[model samples]
Target: MPPATPDAALTSATASPQQAAPDAQGGVVLAPVAETPPKRPRAPARERTIGTKVAGQPAFVLHSYPYKETSLIIDLFTRDFGRVALIAKGAKRPHSQLRGVLQTFQPLSSSWVGKSELRTLTDAEWVGGMLPLEKTALLCGFYLNELLVKLLARDDAHPALFDHYVSTLNQLAHNEPATIVLRKFERALLKETGVAADLGRCTSTRAPVQADVTYVVDPERGPRPERASDPWPRVAGKTLLDMEREDYQDAATQSQSKQLMRFLVAHHLNGAPLNTRQILVDLSQL
Candidate 1:
């Protein structure tokens, strides 16, 4: 819950999408890439079911665990259906078709059929083309997955956030600054989850934030002038404004936003600890 200490707070996919390049204004911009549509599922008759089928759904495997003998319970982050739990029958079998298909950070077009909370995965195939995450980027990818698995609700849809997620992955794979990529995604995730508030103005006065003024962000509200007794992280108004514009060009914004987001995320989680966050903190990465 709050990273165990203030220092903990301070320590903090999709297709072959094109690399992200900064615009003339030096803002990161993702070039739109064409996505190859997923082919229809080809499965045995016995595996096919009519129970509310969703086919060719863009997705990534957030996490999976062994369920029974050779089976797995997969948590998927889908474009249209948010997070979903599916039973991957026989995935653990050596020759199972899904053995190579279900992997984290790899794009997939998943098909399933079921009305229950745990659906049956009928078919899945890797939608290749994107760069694979390596080294620190790989760990950062896991961190992103952890956040989605912990924060996003099942069956909820967040299309914009999903797109941004893809772009974030692309940036990370390209060796772009991890801190900036993560900060942007965290902000987007918080916004999509309906927790983030505008940081460009004061919650109390509704006046534009002055760059040099120090402020404290209220997770439930927005930013406000800091008081003597406030215990939250005190960030400069410039940091808040820079984060609002998704700009991390400034060194101060990078450091301050990290701590601010760490505190806010912990607040929203109601004191639940983020495992990957702790790992990143230990590694001095992120």
Candidate 2:
């Protein structure tokens, strides 16, 4: 077309770059820009999972603590589920049904829901064992509880360890010697958790522990000869062999086994004293 006015050209150039249509009033209209939708937040992962029946499983309450005003959080070691935490709602009430059934070391048929680290305990029915642990045995039972609480991780199942625990409790309840039963359980716990040292063989010589020889228990590496400078206890080869066979009945084996396990457990515990040990020591003198 012929030369346009400066104002008209400027208006055409500055207008939006989209093709415009005529309005009712014969004015050019620009299309409206679309607004973007806002983003939504993601939901957290569900803790519960679907599963089949866990009915009639053998289990025991390892320990428990007050959760709030009327509830308690129980740590259980079940035959199938291993170590799991359960919230026993209203378990703290004076007449709560669960109050009588959830005592430690008593066998129970426990039902819980969810695959969460903390499961909700649905039901608990007591299954009595031999008899209640009393005197020294009771303290030993608490010592076992403390070990499990410190070493075992939540929701991690160890069926063999569970069985061993049940057996240990039964032994303790039957008035078995505290030192013997505790040593057996401690060794089993260590083995089940994959921290047990080789008791039958020498680390350097790769030979069976001989009854005539004296050896040092290396907590990290197993049994070896006592070095000229090492301060750990030197155990007899017979003691190592006895430990390997779980034979604490022999007098010599019992004595050396205690010293060996003490060295090994203390090494793993890194000088952190077990309160139960001190309690036992105090009670023995009285």
- Can you write out model 1's per-residue Cα lDDT over 123-144, one digit (the tens) per residue? 9999997899998899899999
Model 2 spans with C-alpha error above 4 angstroms? 1-54, 284-286
Residues 1-57 of candidate 2 have per-residue lDDT tens digits of 789999999998887566477899999887754556798766432222223224566
* Candidate 1 stretches greater than 4 Å from native: 1-51
- Checking candidate 1 for backbone clashes, the offending pairs are none
TM-score of 1: 0.82
Candidate 2 lDDT trough over 10 residues, lowest sum: 44-53
lDDT of 1 at 109: 97
What TM-score do all the candidates reach, one by one? 0.82, 0.77
> Which candidate gets the maximum lDDT versus the true structure?
1
lDDT (Cα) of model 1: 0.91
